[model samples]
Target: MQSVAKIRLADALVKIMEKEGIKYIFGHPGEQILPVYQALRKSSIKHVLMRHEQSAAHAADGYARASLQPSVCIASGGPGALNMTMGVATAYKDSVPLLIITGDVSSNLKGENVFQNIDVNAVFKPITLQSHLIDDPDQGIEIIKKTFQSLKTGKTGPIHLNIPRDILQKEINPSLLDESVEINIKTHWKDINQVKRLLRKSEKPLLLVGAGVLWSHAAGDVKSFAEQHQIPVATTYPARGVIRENHPLSLGLLGTRGTQRANYAGKNSDLILAIGCRLSERTQKGLGNAPIIQVNLDKTVLKGNINIQADVKEFMEKISPTSTKNTEKWLHELQSYNKVHKIRTNYDKTPLKPQMAIKEILDGIGSSILVNDAGSHTTWITLLMEVSEPSSLIFSGGFGPMGYGIPAAIGVSLARPDKNVVVVVGDGGFQMTSQEMATICELGLPIMICLINNQSLGIIRQWQELYYGGAFQVKLENPDFVKLATAYHLKAKMVDSPSEVLAAVENGLKLNKPLLIEIKVDKNEDIPLPK
Candidate 1:
């Protein structure tokens, strides 16, 4: 290595981050991370001081989801790191790529009950693709580079780096850092002829796009493949915007709160070309016997009837969609089913239904990115919202976190400043991270929050009504949301009836500022899942 000027390890790490185009680092300051804070302050990377460490992680997640790039979040030792576990687990389950950095006790204090010290590496093992404790300051840049490279290689998820305070404060030679290391990923192709033969053989074929398409940036290729083959496409929650939901051959979302049309199409398909998706429980139902051609970046995820372990984009690119077979009859059958399974969204009710409110919101907002929190409202959006482009809709998936929408929307707004960013949340979930409204005010970013003020945990209450004989503890009393927004110096309104929803949403969108529209929905108005 060439001899170069020496700098503090923390500064060297921040320098490498700047080299990699990391514009921001979401985190909280602490005693152990003081060096990191000082280094970041001097460098070009701006650190967002979050209200809580959990929000820091979620912000990183939302940023990565919208930007399609790996994001970084930092936290202090022990309690701070523990606080980040929920957000880390949320990203792990959803397969979002995030780099989590946590401060730790000094190397000399290992296992000595040091203040704010815990087994950070062991705690994050289950939730991260890789977890390491930096014992030597010299290895910091290499480790950071390796972590970043690993996330971009194949199956993407969260990774943890626990840097001891002593190590971060140690001096390191700048020339020792490998700043030019590039991510080299290659997909080993299997036999494509057999997959092609199967595609040609099938009468009714359905292309199931998953989160992998978003990771691989293959939405365009997937769209072209579907259009050329004239195949109906169904998506998982993370893959909602793989294609325009308004496309003629689109089947919207599949599984959980999936559209009746999408579910029906999946059930009837003779062959399923599942690309970049893990055919998990949310997207897979009653398709056990169907011949599945599963394509994924991770080979382990391809455990279907027929599996292809290659880069999703490369695999999709090689597949010829120019099928000579005339499958108009099969396409017609799925399209007919789609028409028959159309959901009713124009109900005129006093205390507005969730579906009706969602319909108006979708109709009112034109081509804007939608972010949703996990709750009964998520089901409504998955079923009702028609998303067309990738990165258009982001939500907590496998983890189903309650407080994700508000902060994640803030992150999304930061990433997608050119597009209008909207968030939908239930009253129960909104309060969990409603404090982020303050974050929005501080940043001065215009975000529209559609709060479904249903006076209970709607999903839990519905389950209790159905199974637990109308059990209790689900009812909630909310502070006047309009007042809540006003306290934060934000524009807010409350809509009481379905008739008033569109006008309220229209007015909020027209404001072009931080606006919250709290729709007072009936507690008893529950949408049972489609049969």
Candidate 2:
């Protein structure tokens, strides 16, 4: 610690965050967090105040997914922190790098009948990669460093740090940062013999890639291996744009709504080389109930169809992309499968399907950054949207959180100011965090947000229709997003017919400010997940 003019402890907290390169945070101010608010007012860290804590948490999750960078969120104690727990869990499960900062009852007041005091650490422990209480103000720097290191370690996820009201005002020395040593993380390696035997022996091989591919920016390496060996590729929803959809070996997406070619190959492959993906039902076809060689950083993934637990990068690095090998038989067969059904863009002719509009956005945007919120709207987007680059598609595959798309688009735009960022969110999910439009407006960060106004939580409706004989409740009704967008002083256009979509999206993108394009999607559109 060094001496300086007396500064508010809260200001010091914000300063530490700013020094770590956090551009913005999504949060809701509350009484327990009043001191944080007071300090934030004077600090350089910009916060997006949301209507609910969950939305803020999801937005942070979204931000992390979009930029491959850590995103932050703050909430009041008790119900406020409780409200954000699921979203935090979503990020943790999905392996998103997020920092969730929650306010708590004064440290001195804990267990003394204090208002807004809850065991946030206990509740967050199961979800977060790490959870800590800032018991000593002087230890703030150390806690933050370790928190970030833990959250950013291989196969990163969310971490939680609770700052009590009284603790936020304690001043501490900055010298701790000098004494902190950054540690290197070694990606776990696999048995060379096992991996070598699998690659050398397999005749029918298929490569399934996911968001982890882009997270590590190994699309080039994966592509190199595939091209060298002529391995056909099938992507999961979260990994839609990891490689060009039209590439000779790329099968776009795999699952119910995925291309028929991809699914057929999954069913036939003797060796399913799944990398950076958990092989979710939509992608794995329930693990194909077959032999699968899954490569992921998480050891828990081994419980499923996974045969090995080595980091994808580590394994790929060890195995030379065998120019000596050929997968011609497998590639030819899968291509034949791709040719079987002749995948069609039927939504173009269908009556106002949300997927049709999604196609239009993809068609017009080419390869711009895309963020898909969790829900049915995501289903339509993932199945229909086309992208040309790796890491271009960002979605909550494991940490499925609604209201994540829009705020994450803000982060995308901030991270890559030159590129256009688009967010696709369902009406039910949109309204949950639509208040963030204020944040978008305040920053004047241009982003095009498409709200699929289906008037219901489409995914839950689909689930009810499937297993519960359509016993849908608490999934109905949606607010007018145009009105909500107007209140936030952001430009918004409502599209009810197919004819109005392209022009509205174009106008929205052209605007120099935040814009929302709301499409009156059919509530009856029972879209299914892509295979």
Candidate 3:
């Protein structure tokens, strides 16, 4: 008979993380989570100590978005755990997979008004796919397995495992746990005959994709299907990179900040094939009553006129090529809209128009991972920036949270060392998580952040100007960002004119260390919206 080795529950937890192929754990250590921190020190898995618990979850969210794999984050109970809710809710809304382990007060202290103790399981229930409270040490590993299983199957989202301090410190037998369970989610492959029939009958067909396509690794499939049938494609915010923006058949993004051609194409199409997208109001508003052939792994979201419940990749794999009705005139009409509604990105303003600066920067960096923080700048970047590859642009789409760009850029830089990472953030949003510059400097990550300094909460101020009287508290007083970056041991520069934009970007790209290039723009300038 084989003998089972005894180990601390915290140590056993690390073993499971290792088995799951997790490379790094991003979080902060606390009094309650000391055991896991102690175990992490002796294990090979690297732990990134974040300054704020919220940024830890954002970093993990970024890793999952970039890698298309679930990432783990840890938080101490009470305030620490509560701070992580926004990140978890953001992931859930966007269908990003994450496993968050929170450490609570000791089991004996439950219901005794102990420090760092709350009904965590109840608080996280609405935001997670599954929330498990491990009350017994013997069943802790089992709960971990079940959490991962839930993450692997069905529509991917965040999951939480609450471990009391005593349970994390208790001893457990390692050999008794199962280590070889399947991790891939099973798919119910649907027939594509009806889809083919719809394709043949339609005169103008358009395809809309979202983050689900990126999560399932179906970018190539999406591209192939579009090209094979000569159908035009557009994507939501999170799916910006799934279809290369430079493709001739691409309509760019569609939403409030979308291009005019994309919106026109989506509104006029006779038949719509929405794949892996939830078609939220942001993507579906004002879209005419067109018959939609929706394909998704989650049946709840497959309520289109023609619904197909299947994996997007598998559906594309099994699809048979067939002749379709002519769409050349429709394509030409969309192309004409592009010319009539072209956005002015070549302004020669002295204080440099934000769009012109973005254009110059894009010209300098051909194709790289772009991260955008939530603000007026997000609208400009998503509408103007060209994506040349899939999974190359990360956005806080569902939650639209500020302070996501800097930390997310760090995570992407760490995950893809071979590629360059660029961040575009407004002055207001940049200040929210600028402290992550310390983390970037500590890790020596190669990322270039283009801070758009408008010196106000640009978007909210715009809202105030249009609706209600002009509100105060919108203007901001910021530090000298260049000096701040220099203080953090990073190369920095400030651009005040259009002529200086490209050169600054070129210089930032040459450095092997972190860089922050601040572009000063007019605070009163508004992001151009589609007419």
User: Which predicted model would earn the best TM-score?
Assistant: 1
What is the lDDT for 308 in model 2? 57
Write one digit per residue (lDDT tens) for candidate 3, span 1-531.
Answer: 967778999998998888788898989888888899999988888898777888888889988888888899999998989988877888888888899999999988987887667898899999887888898877778778766776655577899999988999889877736644444454554547878888889888898887778777888988988888889999888888787788999988886677778888888999998999887878886366889888888766666887777778877786636678888888888888884346688767686787788778777876678888898887677666788787788888888888888877877777788888999988888888898898988998889999999889988888888796985799999999999989988899898897688998877788867999999988888876544
Q: How many steric overlaps are in each model, in order?
A: 1, 12, 0
| TM-score (all chains, Cα) for each model | 0.95, 0.87, 0.94
* Prediction RMSDs, each to the true structure: 2.2, 3.5, 2.3
List candidate 2 stretches off by more than 4 Å: 1-16, 31-45, 138-140, 182-190, 286-291, 304-310, 321-324, 339-353, 457-480, 528-531
lDDT by residue for model 2 (41-155), tens: 8767777776678778776866676677788999989999999987788787777788888888889888777677778899999998778988787677677777766655556
Window of ten residues with lowest summed lDDT in model 1: 179-188
Evaluation by TM-score, superior candidate among 2 and 3 = 3
Highest-scoring model, lDDT: 1
Q: For candidate 3, what is the TM-score?
A: 0.94
Error of 2 at 358 (Å): 3.3
TM-score, cand. 1 vs. native: 0.95
Global lDDT of each model?
0.84, 0.74, 0.83
Which residue pairs collide, candidate 3?
A: none
